[model samples]
Target: MSDPVAGSTGTAASGGAPLLGAADLKVTFAGRRGSPEARAVDGVHLDIAPGEIVALVGESGCGKTTLARALLGLEKPTTGQVSFDGAPLAYDSRALKAYRNRVQLVLQDPSGSLNPRHTVYEAVAEGLRIHGYTGDERAKVAEALSRAGLRPPERFFLRYPHELSGGQRQRVVIAGALVLDPELIVADEPVASLDASVRGEILALLLSLREELGLSALVVTHDLGLAWNIADRVAVMYLGRVVETGTVEEVLTSPQHPYTQALLSVLPEAQGEPVVLTGEPPDPTRIPPGCRFHARCQVLASGEAERTGVAQSCRTKELPVLSAAGTAQVACHWAAAKAGASG
Candidate 1:
């Protein structure tokens, strides 16, 4: 069945600039009083080409959300920088409004995002009003609702959030984001809470919207299944850093990072990885030294050596960098060597 969202999008040619980019972005959060602060996002670089969907996949505490917040200027980075096209944004009301008009976010929860007190029209029109979209506001609101498949637009426009189904409410959230005609979207686990039947639809919706609207989207999802279905590129984040990145085909089929291998191994056969990592990741606050994945690394150590090796890795050792001078950028010592040999 054709997704309702895909059906709503207007076909158009892309004429926009690169939607969003983060160059050497770093975000560090204060830790305990005595200890050093942890780097939530450290020297991260990312690019979102026009009309593309890039999936930032990782476990819950991997700093994916912090990067997203940095993209939105919600979390101030200690170093590095985030920009849109070429304009730098400040973390203030004026800058926020400008960023809101140019870039938008589709939050995970549909119900929480839309105000129950406001009608659908009011909710969708909120960005337009805030961003000073003065010309034909009602027409624009109706058009956005129609574009999002809240069809027979007139009836749905006046309805409240409580009046819609879960899928429909999520669509409303998407419509609200789209109403401003944003250049980029930061979708933080946009489908994690939806029903199985609805998840694919949401993903397809996001992709189709990108095609029609020329939007660059950063999709945050733990589900590799969703990334495989829609993302053009994949970035695997671990403990606040990008451990691996490449085209979806390369990363999914032959991931180079040990953490990426561990993550892929846990996926179903049709998805990726057939070998799962042995244990849980080390604590983020006290992340091991040499290689973060060294503790669970199969080839790295024996019993006492395993613990000892982790300590050695945890020291201020010079770590290998992720490179794409191949299709994938991998950070693991073994995987990088393997990639080097193959190339």
Candidate 2:
């Protein structure tokens, strides 16, 4: 059967509510008393329905991690809200605990995330204990480890972080998340640290778990290939904002925003010469007066944007809000022109 979370039908088919969502989410960090505050996550809106895997793609320092933290309520948003199952999340201690029980996080580095001193059993059992699981803890831990593909489960129960291979350590981390039987998981750079051969295995495991358990996931990574490999949808982030969002095939194959185009151009499988963007990304403390990406955008740099006066608009007007463009939603003044040209 087609999974409801995989987007084969209407939202009602998936229980009429997004499993998790963020609306107008923003997170700002105070700088020195007089200095401008740093905008880490800026007005990001996203949603994950049941059983869906959405990849959040962006370069370093683009606030993907900050957005993830906000969704989990680990970092309170400076503005906007995170909703789960159609209701806004509350910050009360009891509410936060209940939210966390349903949404877990898998960090980028297994070696760093898992305590070297804790044996595999302890690490996996920790979440169960914290959540007040009263059933047979041993069975729960073993089932979680088994689900994460550490077969026999018993074989890995006593292994420490140093004793297991990198892949195995990552699995232990995943088991910890699974032990909670969460409805959603926010995985940050889940495979960036693993060996090339092991990365595919880990990704496959996640996809399999989604099929078997009906879990939703928001996978944060800079790897376009990873999005293509596993995600049903893709969100392209730049300078703390989402510039484009669509299915993996829609966004990757025919990117609408200039930043998205520039990203796709560099993919090894892409045929053209890499599109080298000019200028370093602006400091978060002083994001440009208009579109945050206007400074480095190739389209704006080219004379094309000048002809349509879009370049001037990009420099002086507020960044365009995301709007529909065929199958994708793109935030750009020049998207229509680019889409027409591509068509």
lDDT leader: 2
Error of 1 at 254 (Å): 1.1
Q: Write the per-residue lDDT of candidate 1 for residues 1-343, one digit (tens) a residue.
A: 1212221111112334445778778888787887877777876777676677788999887889989999888888888778777776678888787887878888999999999999999999998887878699888988888778778777888899899988899989989998888888899999988898988777777777876777778899887767777777788887767888877777877666657666766665544436545667545566667666676765564343333334344333546544312246776656544556678
Q: How many residue pairs clash in all the candidates, one count each? A: 6, 0
| Pairs of residues at least 3 apart in sequence or in different chains that clash in candidate 1 | 264-273, 288-314, 289-313, 289-314, 290-313, 290-314
lDDT of each: 0.74, 0.85
Residues 1-343 of candidate 2 have per-residue lDDT tens digits of: 1122244221333445677888888899999979999999878778788888888999888888889999999999999899998899999999999999999999989999998889999999999888899999999999999999999999989989999999999999999999999999999999999999999899999999988998889999998888888888888888788889887777887787888888878887787789998898646787886678888988888877888667877888886555212236887878765666778
Task: Give the lowest summed-lDDT range of ten residues in model 1.
Answer: 3-12
Off by over 4 Å in 1: 1-18, 32-36, 270-282, 298-316, 320-327
Best by TM-score: 2
lDDT of 1 at 48: 71
